[model samples]
Target chain A: MVGYLLRRIGMAVLVMFVALSVNFAIPRLMPGDPVEQQLAAVSAAGGQTGDMAEAAAAMRARLGLDRPLAVQYLAFLANSIRFDLGVSVASYPQPVAEIVLAGLPWTIGLLGTATLLSFVVGSLLGAMLAWPRAPKLLKFLALPVVVLSAVPYFILGIVLMALLGILWPVLPVAGGYPFGMVPNADFATALGIAKHGVLPGLSIVLASLGTWAVAMRGMVVGVLGEDYIMLAEAKGLSERRIFLAYGVRNALLPQFTQLALKLGLLVSGAILVEVIFAYPGIGYRLYVAIGQKDVFVVQGIVMLLSLSIALAMLLLDLIYPLIDPRVAARSA
Target chain B: MSALAVRGLCVEFASARGIVRAVQNVSFDLAPGERLGLVGESGSGKTTTALSLLSLIRPPGRIASGEILLDGVDIARATPSALRRMRAARIALVPQGAMNALNPVLTCGAQFADLFAAHGAPGGTARIAKLLASVGLGVEVATLYPHQLSGGMKQRVCIALAIALRPAVIVADEPTSALDVIVQKQILKTLLAVQRDIGAAVVLVGHDMGLMAQFAHRIGVMYAGRLVELAFVRDIFATPRHPYTRMLIDSLPGFGARGVFKGIPGLPPSLLTALPGCSFAPRCPRAGPRCTVEMPQTRILEGGGEVRCHDA
Candidate 1:
């Protein structure tokens, strides 16, 4: 088991390295020179019309753009390992790491909870719908959820914003929390965050819940067909126990793998929902970075998301046997 | 009273074409400690017959009509709750496909715990260990999952589970068929040994006539959901009455027994649409005009047992 985990960790490192290298290369491949753009903007801000070429040269040298491509790539690799993404070309003064981290909590707080909530609630409901004598109405629930999953996350976010935010006015339309509200360990502040999150979080959950539920439903139906289920019945296990132990437990195995893969994406937040809600999150920050061609911030966020996904998947694979005895025995 | 008696048991499945009468008017009785082997080809409804005895048939297929009398009560007429009670406690099934018979993710001990708990019986480690030991398995095997065990070992665990509650009847549906020849004999011996200790009447289902001859004191031959003949181990082997039973006995590849190897000709009739006469008519060499036009009634022999044939 220890060896297995070590192997996974090694693979995670290799995966992250490749992802980070791609993150570095993509920005360099972009059309405009962000350093020149920053230089031009900085000179304009200082109200100086002198030495534009010299200023551009100084900016390029300071940002390591004056070095050879190989040396710059090596420097980028080293800086990335230390989480030392340079200052954003769009914001010019703000460090990309600091800016990205500022949005991390909102994304984790809203999208993370929503994503987990969708899996938990969706899987339970899906298992119920797939129950041996499940109600006719329960089977019909797949229709709306399928439709919701079919709608693009952003479109769902927009529709939710329009209906709940504008028409009903039941929840806040934008932002992670109340403006100027300090999110200390107080009921009022937490409630404020949840209230503001309702519309955007609902948008994400609605879109994601359907997919998880649908997947879980299919898995449960398949598990029910297995011969062990027949043997379980022949053994006289009560319907409820069989449903949980024989049906749901085995069915949840694939879902756990899916959940592990989705964890990294959740950290990035549902980009559309975050944008529609104007919620300050990593996804929204990534969007702004792309629009202004803030290469450093984009690279930092991408690297973080990729590293998180790889490491999380490794952890999930390592932890899989603890929950599933079949995998445990096989791995052993 | 018999240990278990099934009367007019009819099982059917609603498929796209129509209802398939899987088991039709099947009636049989098993006395305490008696071993009855149900033998036939695939889709002969042996497995379905075994499953329906405990009301274990699932949707699209049901015991349409039957009286599964155990302890003088009709299990077929039993409610869902009563049927649940009968399962594992009143009667148990050593289901086919032992490898897949167990919950793959559960340890052998956990499975025993489930069966014992359902029957309101004790299932601590010590009791389970003793049960495992009876089947020639070690206590350590209780900790291992199904995948960790070989085919024979899994079958042994299945035997242990069936005897856990010590029900009056233990139905083993093709318990040893999944195993290789050597392992098949070993598993069969384990099943018989465990049956002796538990004192449960055994219902062994299989197509291996030789194995059944070895284990079963009486054998029942089913053809297309109908019990063609059921007689003593001595009678069925020596002087089988039913043409189907005789053919089954004759077809056994025996050592040094030389005759032209005559396999039963033609397929068993489909149960989707009704067969006007005997399902075995097309396959039976002794099939006559009456056999082709009219379904033969079961005849009770003076010696013992019954046969459904025009020329029995």
Candidate 2:
């Protein structure tokens, strides 16, 4: 078992390296000229083009974009290993790692809570939908969920944003918190941040609920056919006990894997939801970095996203035996 | 009184094609401490008949009319809750394909505890261990998952579970059918041994005539949803009445100076369309005009057997 985990960790490290390498290339390949954009912003603030042009050359040499691609790749690899991604061109002197790290909590919090809530609710609804003696009206719910699931997350986010932000104006539409509020650990500020988060989170939940329910319904209904379920029934287990202990317990196995994969995406945040709500999450920050031609910041965010997913998958593999003992027989 | 008595049990399946009469007027009585073996080909309605005893048949299939009296109480008329209470407490089933009947995630001990707890007789580890021991399995076997055991060993766990609550009637549908010949015999012996120890009336369903002849006290021969012959195993074998029963006996492999066993001539009739007369008449050698025109009712022989044929 130790050897298996060690091998998995080894594979995870290799995956991280490959992903970071691709992340390093993406920012370079993107259309914008980072140095020129930075120079233009600085010159516009206070200086002549001639002096700023010389400063741009000096900045390029300092940032080492003047070197060959292979050499830069090695430097990025080493710097990433040391947790040192270059300074963001969008907000110069601030390390790319720092900006991404600052936004990490918001994205993780919003996406994590939204996805968890939806999966729990959706899976419950799905399992109940497949309930052997489900009420007539409850069975009809499958149609609406099927229709709702087909709507993509971004479109749903935009639609929700328009309804709540523009039409009703019931919830705050933009930013993580009020512009002049002094953010603190106290209850009021936390509440403000949470209130601001409601729309984006709701968008994510609404967008994903249908698919999870549909998937779980299929799995639970399929498990209802297994011989063990028949045996459980013949054992005289109550309808509720049989549904939960035998039905849902076994049906959740496949969905649990899907859950892990989805949760792994929490680090990236929901780009569409974040953009529509103007929530200050990593996804929105990523949008800012791209708009400001901050290549290194984009690279850092992508690297963080890939590394998290790879690590989450590794953890998933290691935890499978603990959740279901049948996997232990084969994996051990 | 018999442990189980069924009168005119008929099961039908409603499909897009039509209403298929899967089981037609099947009736029998199983006395306490007796083992009745049901032998037939696949799709012969043996499993359906067994499942209906507990009212556990799947949808599209319903018991059209029947009286399933367990210890003289009719299950067909019992309320859903009452039926649930009687299921594992009064009657238990050792399902076919023992390998798949257990929750893959659960250990043998968990299955035992689940069954015992659900039936209002919660069992501890010591009790479950003892039950497993009774089936020739070690106490540690309870801690082992079903996949860890061989096919025969899994069936043994199923048998141990079947007798755990000391149910009055145990219906085992082809318990040994999925195992190898050697393992099948071992499972059969263990099953009979356990049933003997508890003295539970057993209804063993299988396709092996020779094996059933040895283990079962009486045997009911079924073909195309109808019981053609019902008799003591000795009487059935010594002087077979129904030609279908005769065909089943003749088809078994002989020991000394063996000759090729002649299998029955034609396939069993479809349950969809209505039959003019006897179902086996189209396949019987002595099938005549009257046999085709009218179905024969079950006739009681002088010695001790029920034969459903015109010229028995």
Candidate 3:
């Protein structure tokens, strides 16, 4: 088991390396100079007047944009390994790593809770609906879930904001917490932060719960036909016990892989949700970094997201054997 | 009183095509410690009847009408909680293809332990070890997962699990089908010995009439959702009443007895649409005009046997 985990971790590191290298290369290769654009904006705004060639050269040199691509790639790789992402290009004084760290907790607080909640709710509902005697009401309840799952998260977020925020005025339209509310350095402050995080957290849950419900429903239906479930029934187990112990447990095994993969990919969508809610999260910071062409900030956020995904997948790979001994024995 | 009595049992399924009858008006009584072999071709409703006895049929299949009396208690009308207690504790089933029925994720010991746990029986390491040993498996077998065990070994585990509660009746649905000939004999022997030791009624369902003749005291032949013939094991072999039963016995290739073995010709009838008369009329050599228009009711013979046929 240890050896298998080590192998998976090794593979994940290689994948992360390849991912970050591509992330670094793509922006540099894109047509147009972000520094030049910033300089042109500054000049247009009448902030400064200087020789055009010298100013362009100074801006390029200052941003370290004149170096060879290979040199810059190696330096970025080294810095990435040591968790040293260079200063923000748009916000020159601040370090990228610091900015990302400050915003990460908010994103995790919202998306992470939503992910867990959706999986649990969806999986349970799916199991119930998979029952042969399940009422038509459940099917009716499930139709909306399928429709909602097909709708993009941003659209759902917008609809929810428009309905609940604008029409009903029940929730705050934008922002993670109330204005000027600094996080206190104690448990009470943490509680307060969680309390204020409800609407943004619920927005994510409402958006993603349908997909999980559909996936879990399909999983339960497939599992219901397995030989072991028949055996469970033959053993004279109560319907409820069989549903929970045998049916749900076995059905959820395949979903674990889906859940793990989603956990990693979800960071991308978290940015949009964070923006919608005006949440101070890594995704929000990433959006700002992209707009300002802050290479260092973008690199830091991308690497962090990549590492998180890799770690989650690695954890999932390890967890598979514990849930299913067949995999463990095969690998062993 | 009989150990178990099933009367006027009719199981039907509401399929998209129509209301498909799987088991119709099947009636039988099992004596204490008696082994009854339920013989039939596939889709002849033998397995369906066994499932109906336990009320294990899931929807859209249901027991439209039936009375399953276990030791004079009507199990068909029992509450879910009552049914749960009756199962395994009173009546158990060694399900068809049970070799693949074990939980793949759990160790054999854990699976057995769960069976005991579900029944509120005492489950400890020592009890599990003893149970494993009883089934001709070593203590090490308990630590292994289902995949690690061979087909025969898995079947043995399944048998051990079924008999764990020492129920009054054990319904085995083709228990030896997946096993090799050698393993088949061994499993049958083990099952016979266990049944004898517990003094329980054993209901064995299979297509192989020869195997049934060897173990069962009484044999019930089913054809297309109806019990056509049921007699003492000796009588069933000596004077087979139903043509289907006769064909099934004749088809068994007798060792060193050279005679052209005639396999039963014609397929079983479909149960989706209601048959006006006899289900086996299409295949029966003696089938007449009346056989096509009117269903034959079961008739008790003078010689302690039952046959459902117009000519009988």
Candidate 4:
């Protein structure tokens, strides 16, 4: 077990190192220069109009863009290890890490809850649909869920925003919370945030519900045919226990692996949904940074995304043996 | 009283073409601690007959009409809860394909715990160890998963599970067919030993005549979903009545029998269409004029056995 853990952790570290190298190379390879872009934007806005070439050179030196590629890459890796992402070019004087951290909580709260809710409910619905003894009426639910899953989540968000925000005027159409209200730890503020989250979160859950259910239903149907299920039934186990312990327990392995991968992509995957709702989450920040040619902030977001995915997979490997005895036995 | 009495058990499967009578009017009874072997070729309904004993046949196949009387309870007509209560506590099954018979993710000890807990029996480590020991498995075997064990060991674990609650009837459906010849004999011996320990009637289903000869007290020969011949082991081997049974016995490989192995000619008839006459009549060497147009009724012999052939 200890060896398996160490191997998994080592794999995760390797993946993170590759992600870091790629993050360093991608922005440098992009067509436009960050310093030149910022300088041009400032001149166009009529904020400063002096010494264009010299100011650009000074900005390049300050941002470490003037150094050799190898030196810059080594420095980038060292700084990334210390969580010291440099200043955002667009949002001058603000560190990229601080900007990313500010949006991390919102994205985690909204996307994490949405993903988990859809997985649980969809998996249950699918299991029921595949079960021979489950209610007959529940089978009809598959059609609508499948149709909803086919529609893009951002489109669903727009439709929801129109219906609830304008037609019925019940939910907030945009933003993370009410305007002019500082986000704090109080019942009223928390409730307001939740209210604003409903449209975007619901859109996400509704769109993914079908995918999870369909996958789960197929797995449950296959599990129902296994010899152990027949023996479990013949063992005089209660139907509830048989369905849960024997049926769902075995079918859940693949779904758990899929869930870990989905969670890894959670931050970047929420970009469209956050844009539709104008929510101040990491995806939205990444989007804005890319548009402003804020290379440092974009690199930081990509790094966070890659590391999170790697960490999720590592956690999955660690817990796999607990859920499935065969994994540990096979690995050993 | 008999431990199990199956009366006119007919199992059918609904297919695209029509209803297939997998087991037609199959009836038998088992006294406590008796071993009855149902031997037949593949698709001869032996496994179906065994599965029907515990009402384990799934949809597309069902017990069309029958009364499985166990300890005065008619399992065919029992409610869902009553059937559940009677399943592992009154009748258990040691399924075929021992490799997959166990839940792969669960430990052997945990599986035993589930079975005992399901029947409202108190299960502890000591009881699990005892069950394992009875099957000649080490106590530590309980802690291992199914994948960690070999085919023979898995079959032994399955046997241990079958006798865990000391049910009145244990149905073993080709329990050793997936094993090698060596493992087959060992597993069967273990099964017989444990069955004797629990004093439970066993319905051993298989197509191996040699195996039936060695282990069964009585043998019932099935041909195309019907019991063609049933008699004491000595009677079955010495004075077989039905032509199919005689052919089955002749096909068995012997010590000095050095020639081309004899195989029964002609395929068994499809059960999709109802046969007006005997199912094995077309393949019978003694088939006569009346055999094609009329069904033969089961006849009780003077020597205390039964046969479903006109010539008998």
How many pairs of residues collide in each model? 0, 0, 0, 0
> Which candidate number has the best DockQ?
4
Please identify model 2 stretches exceeding 4 Å from their true place: A24-61, A65-74, B255-261
> Candidate 3: where is the Cα deviation over 4 Å?
A27-72, A132-147, A166-170, A186-192, B254-261
Per-residue lDDT tens digits for candidate 4, residues A88-135, read 878888999999999999999999999999999999998888889998
| Model 1 / residue A323 / CA error / Å | 1.4
Return the TM-score for each candidate structure: 0.95, 0.93, 0.91, 0.95
Rank ordering of all candidates by DockQ, starting from the highest:
4, 1, 2, 3
* Per-residue lDDT value at B264 in model 1: 85
For B265-308, candidate 4 gives per-residue lDDT tens digits of 99999989877888898898999988888999999997878999
TM-score of model 2 (CA atoms): 0.93
In model 3 chain A, the worst 10-residue window by lDDT is A191-200
Instruction: Give residue A199's lDDT in candidate 2 (0 to 100).
Output: 84
Residue B151 displacement in candidate 4 (angstroms): 2.0
Candidate 1: Cα lDDT at A172:
84
Better of 1 and 4 by DockQ: 4
Give stretches of model 1 more than 4 Å off.
A29-57, A140-142, B256-261
DockQ of each: 0.74, 0.73, 0.62, 0.79
Off by over 4 Å in 4: A29-60, B256-259
Predicted structure 1, TM vs. truth: 0.95
Kindly list the per-residue Cα lDDT of model 2 for residues A1-332, writing each as its tens digit.
Answer: 77767877888888998898778877788898888987777778886556666787798898898899899989988999988987887677999889988888889888989999999989998998988688888778777766777888778777877898889988887888877899999999998998888888888888788888988999999999998898888888888878987899999999889988997888765886787777888999998888876767887888888988998888888888777888766765
